[model samples]
Target chain A: MNVAANEKEVKIDTAYPYRTLSYFVEDPPTGNRVDRFLEAFAVVLQYTDYKSLLDSYCTTNNKCNRCAVSCPVYQVTGNPRDIPCYRTNLLLEVYKRYFSIGGWFKSRLSSGIELTEELIDEMAEVFYRCTACRKCSMECPMGVDHGLVTRLGRYILSLIGISSKALKVSVREQLEGETHNTSKVPKVALLNTLDFLSEELNDMFGVKLDFPVDKSNREYVFFCAVSDYLMEPDTLMGNAIVLYAAGDWDKWTIGTQNYDGINYGLFYSDWHLERIIQQLVQEVTRLKGRNILIGECGHASRSAHDFVPMFGGKEAYPVVSFIEYTLNCLQNGKIKLNPDIVTERVTYHDPCNMARSGWIVEQPRTILKSFVRDFVDMEPKGRANYCCGGGGGLVSIDEIHDFRMEIAGKIKAEQIAATGAEIVIAPCANCKKQLKELVEYYDLPCKVMGLHDLILTAIEIPNGKSAVERKEEAEMFAM
Target chain B: MDAWIEFAKGPLFAVSFLIMILGLGRHLFLQLDGLVRRKGRRLLKAPWRKIFTDSLSWVIPVRHIVDVHRTVLFSVSSYIFHIGVIVVPLFLADHIILWERLLGFHLPKIGTLLADVLTVITIACLLTLLGCRLFVERQRGVSRVSDYVLLVAVLIPFLSGFLASQPQLNPISWRAMFLIHLLSAELLFVLIPFTKLAHIVLFFFDRISQVHWQLRPGAGDMVSETLYGKEAKV
Candidate 1:
């Protein structure tokens, strides 16, 4: 069956299913080249030409075997059938068979293997073997999008009622409002987060911070990843220090409705992603905050930057990241750093989102370097840098721990090792957490700290509003 | 035979020069356009296109063609190939003379010794590339008919030029060699945009795409591959 017809039957019952847009239908016009090929081949469909033979064989990720060197999966497995380049070549052969005379007659006359269930399963395995990491994307010179091609293949698999278990469950949960996304916080967790923030800020900056939770109708609404509340207590507290130091405490309030900064639905489908964003944007609007300051999370920031602009269009809200706010405050002379607190061989691990994905790479680098004494750069710094392996929902996949470490973590470890820096400051919580595990696994000496941790060590709390002041502030808000 | 030599020296050289400049201009323009526009897929999309585009920027698309060591060696050879790709075609006196004939333009030559040195370097680079392709493990496994065809296409011109420059070989041999070289060079030129060669133009484009994606609000929307929630994009 054609790809379109096959995709309609796809079912997502897994943890992360490929959620097709049940709400909106789009006939993603097949690409320019594919359309031309179809039109040209239509004339000789029954003529037993290469057009027919090649068209039949141009199946996605089914194994025509052309990519010889750079496919990361094939690089790991040494299997031709598993590589994406091979699939590309298979399609190329179809192009060659009809257009290039030599390939045409031979392919048309040959009796090729028919598309069977076993063949489909094998193709799926080959397609799934790829992490969609984009290493091969850097290697292939044709600008062939192997990852997207694979996604298309995966989407096709979904249509055939063979969607993965993980994809289905995750999509379903997201749709049903069971989105335990990065920002989703339970009552106890929210309370604990506030308490921790209060303690950390007081202890470090001597600022008694009153971080209010679920306080509706404030001028500024701050959103943070739930993990930041639990693990990176310093970040929450650091934010409190800035707010308290800036004396904008009453103007800023945490959302009583949703604290999760992430919009994971963006990866699975477009419309569902739009809904969550609309809801968040609407909530922030209703809160009537002059500005929405997103905490140190990459993808969350990305969702705001990309989707908010798209969805909000002309009336887009001014959503700013903490880093941006910090830089702005520093630039405007709103805050000053105590140089005595800044002493370390520190190098910023530009979170893939903040640096490459968010265009906030330079600000953090400049800010970190300005505040720190010994600032060094990672070898493949910035956009060219490798992933933390634990990114994308892979960090939560504990069942596949061995695979994650072996495949993804290994590449990251090597990249980190090449950096030869002392401390790798990861601004995002996910990167920080993943790097923490990988550092321990590889026995690396580098310490992974949140971006605010360094800031916390530096910026001094205003007089009379020290740690005690911060603690008093927290108590007042919590009460 | 002399007429063909004269024409090759004059007309063919000029035409080839024009094609190179035009190709280079188009290539560079496309590269800049790709950077500013930043219209490329993400890791979850078609990765090969990204791979292909990125690979071209470094002037080497397929790194797996050689072992890590061999890759370094091949890159070094590629630098030599680049020098030859430029000098032997654009700066040779014969080429200049040909251009002068075709377009009435006279490009200065760097001298005979430099030309001879460049030819030798170019030949050595080609030989090195060929050696790496044949001997490298990953390259050997993936090598196809097209790969061999590209190699021959390069070698024919270099060999013809070397023979043509020699006083011992007949002028006919030189003429025949030049024709073969012209044909091969033209084939390589025409094939560039359609084949993986376009990556040379697309790499910069991909880099810009990376820059653009990094700046978006959902930049941290990294989906974790692990089953647990810890390593995911939180």
Candidate 2:
């Protein structure tokens, strides 16, 4: 584990173009001892053990570039180092130097290369550059899960305190703060936001809508991204209106503490992901809810619906997307939409978590079609859709906003422009944020809206009062 | 010359075959061992079913090749080269004769003309692939010395065999051409298990692992409970 002691003899291979020192800036030592970092790397490798697949990926004759060709980031950047396989190799090279059979032989032949701090910095930079969208995994011939590799790389980097400040702060807030939300919206603030949303909905639709909080024994424990409380109240109002119209008003309630479904842990650290999901499961179980209905956030829904069970074991309740719930309501004739209300040319952006992981691709489209007069599909819609460049917590990192806009977000901007749609329906919260930024930065003639936003505009909410009462009120008004 | 040919066809061939078998067996065994060790409390419901379907899907070029625009040409050329290499070597009269002589079993053979045409096509495809690796900017960035060496190793046998089969087109004496062909083929057999060529057998292992890892049941619920303690009651 004396990795740093042997660092003096480490020879940087200048022959390799990417190994140049110019691409990286050396940071002062931050108490991350080389021995401890090596231990963490070994532990992660043993936990995942992707050696055979990685070996084949690097050595196979085809050197399959399917992941690279399909990767939206790489497609936009055109940097060979950004290729998913190449990025994975950065970790593989470390594994080969210290732990592999070849490394054992090579160590005997020469003082082998040490995993340097600079190399770790480069790994951190490249791994974070990726969105962890898993679109690359879908196309890889060997099924080398690049998403897993990226997350693991980030996890290892996190051990040495090499993660983004933005993501770290969010996780800290959720775990340590009393509010238990990433945005740190307090309980009273959340209730006030809900009350404001109810007022807004009544003003617009002439119907009373209430957002139930902390009620027990509901059929579903609804969770939305915490940012919705302040940034997107319309979306929250849309959720309430749809739920009330669908006759599920009494069937669902939002938890007071664990209402926010945004899980930034899925972006970097496995430790954080597990803790967040456990808290989510505990909230649902405590409420005596029969099901967990995750609202219109891609990674949140994915974390809750897909990874929660994996981390928490089988839950008493089933986890579902609010999109699926709406689709069911539409199918059952409990709710109806007036298509003329949304006459603009609309297109859908498939959040990678929903389309690729959750298989919630068609459900959003179904909901959109039910309300929109003109619905267009992106050229490569569904699972193959390009990332909004803000996934993997990149949207939260303000320092890299330009990097996202000029590079990672480029392909998505182009994809949206190609469709020539005026309205882009991003069902996931993360996608909406990225898409909105892309529209602003690229100056595209399109506006970003949430699926629930569209639903609020077109949904037909029935007046709860009886017809006789309404007629008597009208007669009284005439008198 | 006769002595060299005799050794090439006898001891050299046997030694190479033995190394290839043991090497491939060890490689596949280690991969399977890794798979078993990594299974850890995770349910692989219908693993065999997943492995079979995934293997079948990957073997066909349609999904992996034709559907992806960037890989269509490379995948098509690879498919053609792989078919020619496997089919020509196994079904040619000369190879079947050797197999029958060694193992006392013979299979039906393709016509000599067809075998020759396929061998030529395979060599051409291999050369094209080599060119792509050398010339394609992105591919060149990832290409290593082993990649070039492996391609040359595969190409020598096919090129020499083609020349040996048609003595009229031979660039040297018949005995020399035949020896070069035999020696190169033997070299490939020895190298297959140690080099990237191991992918031939390891492809199944990689694909199966990928499919099973993706399909691992309860992936949604199997928290790294060790990392996070028991769920706290709200």
Candidate 3:
């Protein structure tokens, strides 16, 4: 709850661009287009199962406003509109105006407020203000999910093609484009990256390691956030090393057709959510794998773990998070790590998506306790953890770089600064990137990394070779 | 005035009470109908039992007690206010007599002094809550006209009943205060289903979706048991 003193800090209150989210939207909603807005609302009413959800959120006066205390955005900005309840009401007000029985009477009898493009425009701006971390749902006595309402708002807006262009274009390439992934990495590139990682890892450890690819009927099918292939080689390498320790090439394989696991759809649109999940299931079914092992991306893991059933139905495989799989291996004594290494003052950031439901929170913490010498926890960590201000796909947009650091992530920055950690091990790829920016932006004296990145550094090799020895040997060879 | 009071309590009260019950029932049924329609459509079944049990476990609002320095006072006020709203109306000597007359059943009534004390405390709590909304900038900003209306509407009956019970304290005529009390209570009963007050019954369904809906398949009993200790407790 303590923020570090900054001479150049942007005040969240009474500041224009700091409080305001600036996005280059593809079709910026213009005028009071009630007809188009109503059309989309009607479609949402028919398709989405949010009628019951919006009912409680719209109807309830559970207005204790305690969620403001829980919301990092509201806390930093001191803006009433930034409150989670207020944000949810932005959508619920629309729902009440058009859909509800009370709204039916009120529209004719009372103020006669109808859905307008102006409200939708406000929804577009405000919905993104939240990281959609969902720490707020914990405080609402009515348990109205503010995050779900945000998603529902985004979903309806997406129907009108009014979502973030960053999310839109990436999703475009993922679903319909030639290379069906958000990063648009070609098959050759994915394979080459893995091949190069295998070579790099093998040369360091003096052990032959080939990344299993395109193998049929394997026990585990790996689907990582494609960005991990390029940006986080160590996370992929750690997972590969851990999985190999658990079994071998016979046990796991990455599919050639669609190995990318990122589904930004989880953040915004149900159309994309279902489509991406169906595609992920197809890739798994193509390989006939026994289980789905998702790599170090929180939303990616959540989409597979939770939405697979919602979207895939019969094609749903047992989705295991990379952390969970690695934890299982550690628990089973399949893998070992040297405990004395990674001596820095370390802390973990709970990816709001994974930590919200108590899914991946304790697993990573438990894994960290095994190796980390002085691992500290944020004051209100796990389930109640503040987001890195990069959730809900806010990290992907370069335009909001300062916003993500100065205001959106201010609370998280303070949480880290309070712990005085030299290293922050955020397991999610998005979290790591945002926290890295946060460390740089705020000048927090720390380094940001993935949990598996540490595991890669500390993991004991099978052939009696320690990673320390390998690092020394590589350093000696370089000399 | 006496006749109007009886009229408000008898036929009018019956009609309004029935509307509240039926309207709220319809809302619950529709919500459940939506959930039911989408239930089997998805692959993994939500841990309904655990979710509901955990939700019921949190009914006392002890979670906020952890932040005692900050939100505890407000949460306690809300907790007591809700209790008083339900308990005072049900167990007050006059109301129990009315219930006995209507239902032909034996009922217990609280002492008038105790009931008065609770009514005062509850009124203060409700005022504290409303004052927070009205005075607090952030709370006022998030609030709608309907929110303010709902709180004042709820307050009128309690205020009128307390004043009527003590004729010395009544600024308005005793019969007039009594009439206002009966009519206001009737108005609340009629409006309950149409407004956010419907959350009285619907909180569970709202809670279930947000709390345990994201639970991975087969992790329900485990997580619930670990978090709340055993799944089947009410």
DockQ of every predicted complex: 0.10, 0.32, 0.24
Where is model 3 more than 4 Å wrong at Cα? Answer: A1-21, A27-32, A471-479, B38-44, B47-50, B67-69, B167-173, B211-234
Pairs with steric clashes in candidate 3: none
The window of 10 residues in a row where model 3 chain A has the poorest summed lDDT is A11-20
Query: If ranked by lDDT, best first, what sequence of candidates would result?
Result: 3, 2, 1
**For model 1, how does the per-residue alpha-carbon lDDT over B197-219 read when each residue is reduced to its tens digit?**
53444434433333322222232
Give the CAPRI class of candidate 2.
acceptable
Which tens-of-lDDT digit does each residue in A262-348 have in candidate 1?
A: 665444333345555766676677666666778988767867766676555444677889888888777777776666555558877
Instruction: Give, for candidate 1 chain B, the lowest lDDT window spanning 10 residues.
Output: B219-228
Best by lDDT: 3
- What lDDT score is found at residue B177 in candidate 3? 86
Stronger candidate by lDDT (2 vs 3): 3
True contacts kept of each: 0.03, 0.23, 0.38
lDDT of 2 by residue, B1-234 (tens): 999999999999999988999988988787776666655444353246634654677677586564468867666777899889889989998899998887799888999999989999998888888887888777788777778888899999898889887878987998898899899989999988867788778766655544333223322223232223355111
Q: So what's the TM-score on candidate 1?
A: 0.66
iRMSD per prediction, in order = 13.3, 5.3, 10.7
Question: How much of the true contact map at the interface does candidate 1 reproduce, as a fraction?
Answer: 0.03
For candidate 1, the lDDT comes to 0.56
Give interface RMSD (Å), model 3: 10.7
What lDDT does the true structure give each of the candidates? Answer: 0.56, 0.76, 0.79
- DockQ winner: 2
